[model samples]
Target: SIHLLYTLNIFEFSNTWSLTYFRPTVPTDLWDAIREVELSWAFPGHWLPSKDPVKTVYFSAGRQQWIETCGAVTRMKGLQSFTLHLSGSWFCEPVEKIPVFLEPLRDLHLRQRWQLNLPKQPYYVKEIRNIDGDLRKRGIECSIRAV
Candidate 1:
């Protein structure tokens, strides 16, 4: 399991793969340091066979914040593992648009670690499953947990 610790608007990456992230107002030095780390793409039950540079990301921002920083995220060419803790506002738009927003991450290992916060309606679940299938066909893994 990965833990996201927030403290004084600073983001830190620990040896245990635990990530810390706050608002986009965090210091530039912290972000620069993050881009310089050599990280192992290992999780609790699964392990990656290779090493990468700061490939893991845990992002949890509101819709407004997401809009403000989505461009930066899309430009992250080295990202491999990403976890998104979704908020309700994420569903304000069409669910299909979610994939569109993440189109830039097609090369990522995007495994099943998405945490969704939405009602468990069959329509939403089915749509998400379809998206998951599409991503999987492209060699991307996605799993949604409604919480």
Candidate 2:
């Protein structure tokens, strides 16, 4: 039954698509199985690194959907550090959204020159600084670097 459901879900949705039907209300075991299937579909084979070559991993998702999809991949065990490379005008709501999505991330590097409406306010810088301070207090090292 589980296998059939998994196969059907995969067949209906493309590799990069999300299973919107599967929510947190679902049974724990079933939800875990679905997540495993999604992960497998996203990364076909041999996704893990053999040698621990730099704990930091680089990821860039131009679309909002891809960001949400990759967010799950980031939560996987053994990925302690990350660098999010943003290109184009991706409107990332740092204050409300990003922090929670990237919870428990020990080391994070944000590389982006944000084009904000209020250039004088420097909201992006201030937000990053606040996030950095908050993360630091929780023993997480957050830094911004040039892309």
Candidate 3:
């Protein structure tokens, strides 16, 4: 059954042509299967790095829907991890912004880890380390790796 599945990846979605915009929602029927979610702004093509790499999870969805989704995830009893695969050097700011981006998941008591998959040519290592430290304080294990 789909409910027995353990992972889901919502990498990209589009209305037409290119993957310019998307607002993802896990159907209630499959929420039981969502142990991990791998999200990216654009899917890889022809073995090439995506031009529109994941900058952040601060998607501009409707505010109410965003809150509702956060509530849904918080209710998930089996959610384990969320992977944010960053494809470029867009993380120019300090660790300040990461918390707000991640605040929605703070209520996810069942979530055990948060992984940041970075590009080979990552930009701010120190900033990443700082973000890691902040998440550590929240008791969530964070792993950063260059893919």
List candidate 2 stretches off by more than 4 Å. Answer: 1-82, 86-96, 107-121, 145-147
Q: Considering summed lDDT, which 10 consecutive residues are worst modelled in model 2?
A: 112-121
lDDT score, candidate 2, position 80:
29
lDDT at 126, model 2: 63
Q: Give each model's whole-structure lDDT.
A: 0.39, 0.38, 0.49
| Candidate 3: 10-residue stretch with minimal lDDT | 14-23
Spell out the clash pairs found in candidate 1.
none
| Candidate that would win on lDDT | 3
User: Over 4 Å off in model 3, which ranges?
Assistant: 1-29, 42-69, 87-89, 118-122, 138-141
Tens-digit lDDT track of model 2 for 1-147: 874453345322333354333334445454444322222132221222225343213222223444455554334332222334332222333444444433534332223221112112255556666655665565544454322
After superposition on all CA atoms, what RMSD does each candidate show versus the true structure? 14.4, 16.5, 8.6
Is 2 or 3 the stronger prediction by TM-score? 3
Q: Mind sharing the TM-score for model 1?
A: 0.39
Score every model by TM-score: 0.39, 0.31, 0.53
64-99 per-residue lDDT for model 3 (tens digits): 344454555466555676565655333443345555
Task: State the lDDT of candidate 1 residue by residue for 1-147, as single tens digits.
Answer: 111222122332332223223325545443433322211221221121124433222222223333434344333333333444444344444566556544444543422342223345555665777667665565544465444
Q: Supply candidate 3's per-residue lDDT for 81.
A: 65
lDDT-best of 2 and 3: 3
